[model samples]
Target: MARTNPLQFVQQVRSEVGKVSWPTRREVMLTTVMVFIMASLTAVFFALVDMAIRGGLRGVLSLFG
Candidate 1:
């Protein structure tokens, strides 16, 4: 069996990195914008649901007071 050398490990890492297919800048920007839009939509939906629940609970408590 061949022993592993430290310098050979660095060269191996560089070679593997060179073969990776990275995303383009436009693709990254599009993905980021999509993520933001989805997040904002979810936040608005949850906020409305939370407000409805709070209002209902407030009304129920007021009846018992």
Candidate 2:
């Protein structure tokens, strides 16, 4: 509701930023690698599921046709 002055806003932003515990470069890199690995695994899992579903549909349709 109350407007902060420009200088006060800047100071407040800096103080809040300073309070944050930023990750180290190594930690960031490790987490990034883990994320990529997990994403790849997830994609592979979905791809397999999709192939299974498609194969099942094709088999069922062939039986009727």
TM accuracy, model 1 = 0.86
Would you estimate the TM-scores of all the predictions? Answer: 0.86, 0.92
The global C-alpha lDDT for each of the candidates, from Candidate 1 onward, is 0.98, 1.00
lDDT score, residue 34, model 1? 100
Please provide, for model 1 over 1-65, each residue's C-alpha lDDT reduced to its tens digit, 9 standing for 90 to 100.
88779999899999999999999999999999999999999999999999999999999999999
Q: Against the true structure, whose TM-score is highest?
A: 2
- Candidate 2 accuracy as lDDT: 1.00
List, residue by residue over 1-65, the lDDT tens digit for candidate 2.
99999999999999999999999999999999999999999999999999999999999999999
In candidate 1, stretches whose alpha carbon ends up further than 4 angstroms from where it belongs are 1-3
Residue 41's lDDT within candidate 1 is 100
Clashes of each: 0, 0
